[model samples]
Target: MFIRAESKALNEAIAPALCAVSAKNTVAVLECLYLNAEDGKLTVIGYDNSKGMKTSCDADIIESGCILVKGMKFAGIIKMMPQGEITIATDERNNVSISSGKTKFEIAGMSGDIFPALPELVSEKGITLSQAFLKKMISQTIFSYAQTDIKPVYMGILFEFKDSELRVCSCDGYRISFCKAPFSSGESLTERFIVPGKTLTELQKLLKDDDTPVNIELTRRHIVFSFNGLFFFSRLMEGEFLDYENSFQKVFKTYITVDISELIDSIERAGLIIDDKMKTAIKFIIYGDVLQIKTATETGKIDEEITAEVEGEDLTIGFNHRYIIEALKGAQISGDDKIVMSLNTPFSGMVITPVDHEDYKYMILPVRM
Candidate 1:
């Protein structure tokens, strides 16, 4: 399409949408960014078939047209160009030209007719939540999403909306993270969706402010996130998430409250030594009023004890150091000056809560060292 826009504004729109571009694209059109111009504004869209993103910026339309240009090359050009007006146009021969000031670049574009049709947002089941609350929920749980594809369903985060709250959960079998926030009334009559972790992270990055509210719509196959002139859509994973609630049954035989930073530092240092081990488990040894974290490996052994208000039965439990570190790093601990961890056995899920946040909770499944 023929349109003129500022370089920085164009880059801002292109960067987030480009996250959907697939490196191993099976279709040639999936590798390009689709541009559509209508009335006075131009819209940029990108999708790798499974996930799609659409974003728009104010533009001066000279001619109305649509075309698909190579995503990487277009993004690279936009990012390198200085702050100035950029003019983009496509000819009858499908040649695309991008010009800014004294420089101009031309690249061949494909017909937009071949691009996959975007899924419509079915508003039948949806909810409205503050961007601030949703952002916190995503950041805290997304790290637990599985990185492996052995179990395809585990690779994404689960969104369960029922009654009046949205619960976001993720687990790779070894660790599970759960967070929930209240939803507005008259939302989500009946529905649940599992969104891929990659998609959620992109949405999290695109949201620049916390004051804005995000509109989330869910269909049987796709979930749509809309805010601030941007629309993000992702294909939902198609399997049942594990029965997460049932796994919480194991009571805490021993619970302790310790400094959040101190606990994080202790585990991180222990990980330096545990890095050589295959399991990377850190042993938590608790006595009367203190707790000690230790891990051993070929390099050396790390041992650190932190003061805590320990009660109940004194016990030791093994946990995957990676999971604990991930949860603690983003914790919002307050009031009590300590992080609370409850555990029954290394095989059961361990619950970590910030003393500051009564509504927020983090769960991690421990590993045998």
Candidate 2:
């Protein structure tokens, strides 16, 4: 393919597509980015066996052709090149040429035909939602996936849609992230899909603007997201995720309403005394309108208390530091914003929600300290 594109335009388009380049590939071509230039447009595609991303850019197409080149290296050279148009061309020998200003380089490339075909579902009708909401949903949930592959299915974030409400959920056995956002669907839809945590991480990068709408298409085996002329495809996880609705049924023995920043600040300051070398749990002692946070080890200790609105019962509980830390982060609460936490016992999960916001909930499992 012979095409000319501005350095900024080409670099921006190529960056997101590189997210799908297989980290480990047995086939040489799988590591290459597929480039197709035709009719004044250039299309870039990267695909691992499981996930893929494709993006297009306006280019001066001198000829209609296709080629495959190392995706990362090409992107690097384009990014480093001076701010000017870069010309890319492929020779009959399957070698690729890149030139900008006074610099030029040739890289070996392969036939684009050898690459696995990208999904072709352009004609299918898909749901549309605000890019900002999609980005927020992924950010709030993706972090809660279990780090281990012990429960492979638990390593994904679930997208459940029914009754015209879309819910995004993630849980690692110990803590759960739940966020619900309403959207107008293009058609009547009731479905559930588990998307791997890594896919959403990359999607966060691609879906940059909140004002734009994102088009999403789902198939039996894959889900496709399109926004800003970029297409992202991911293979759906192959198992049924836990029915998360049942997890929130446990009633609270005690519920506390606390300022988001005050609670987060106290937990963070208390965490400083925790020993990095051992498993540590933060203790919460609640009574009246005061909440005490304390943790200790051979090195030192921290005992701190902050104001809270307490009801039902005075309770004491212990939990791993990470659970609460991440839960606070996922809640995305700000100054003056309040959070309500429900606790049954040290053994039951503690569900935390932003006051007045029923659609968002973050749960952390307590520990025995």
Candidate 3:
């Protein structure tokens, strides 16, 4: 296989695909990037059996063929090369040569036929959304995704589409995040799917904060996202996600409205003295119009107070420092200066929402003090 491509365009196309290349895989082919030169285009693919990405760039195709090259090494070579046309060629023995301007390099490649086949890209069910909207939804809720594999379903974010509205929900054992937006498909369509958190993390990096549209196709066991000459597909987790709609408490005994930045700053100050070795819970003492933040550990203790609009009964709650801080940060993403915190008791979870609208909701369970 032989082809000539511009260094910048080739590097940009190869960057996102590398997210699927396994760093430590038993199969060598899974660690390499599959390169197919055909129809005057250079197609690059990276797959580790579960999730993968494919992207193409225009190239001067000399002899159409396919080969697999080490993902990192090949990308590095292309990225460091001069800003000009790069010549890539492979011989019968799979010895690859890369040359541009006066610089040249050679690496070993394997036959692309040995790589695992990707899932079919065709799907009857599909939806289109703006990249910016999708990116914001994921950013607000992905933090609650389970990092462990104890429950396979919790490791993904649930996507629910119905009645011209789209909702995304995610939950770790200790907290839950929910976000929704209006969606128009121009036809009657209802679909629900869970995309692995790892896939969304990588897809978020490739998505731009603009109005560019992204087309999403969904099947029973597979999902595909197409945009800007890129096709990303992943296997869906088959299980029932948590019923997040009913997880949040509807009634609260205590409610407070406080500045988001001030609350985050107070929590960060309390976290400074706590570490992994010290499992101390941050205590919140709310009464009248003052919210006191306190934490005591082997290292030290912090007693900070911030003013807020408090109503209902005075409540005292204890929570993990990291969990509350993360929940607060996630709430801040709504671009709101003030947030409302609703609480029921010392044991019940605390709910955080924006002052104006309910576009996002985050809940954090308190810890035993």
On TM-score, the leading prediction is: 3
Residues 45-114, candidate 2, lDDT per residue (tens digit)? 9988788988888999998899988887888888888898999999999989899888998989998888
Candidate 3 lDDT over 1-369, as tens digits, reads 999999988998899889899876788988999999999999999998889999989999999999999999899889999899999999999999999989989999998889898887668788899999999999988788999989989999999987788999899989999988888797777888999999999899889999998999987789999998899999998898999889998999999999988999999999898886766899999999999999988889899999999989998889988887777777787888889999999989999998886888988899998
| TM-score of each model, paired residue for residue | 0.91, 0.92, 0.97
**In terms of lDDT, which candidate is strongest?**
3
lDDT of 3: 0.90
Q: Residue pairs in steric clash, candidate 2?
A: none
- Report the C-alpha displacement of residue 262, candidate 1, in angstroms: 0.3
Off by over 4 Å in 1: 23-27, 187-190, 333-336
Model 2 lDDT on a 0 to 1 scale: 0.84
Return whichever of 2 and 3 wins on lDDT: 3
C-alpha lDDT of all candidate models, in order: 0.80, 0.84, 0.90
Q: Candidate 3: lDDT of 261?
A: 89
- What is residue 179's positional error in candidate 3, in angstroms? 0.6
Model 3, residue 17: what's the lDDT? Answer: 88
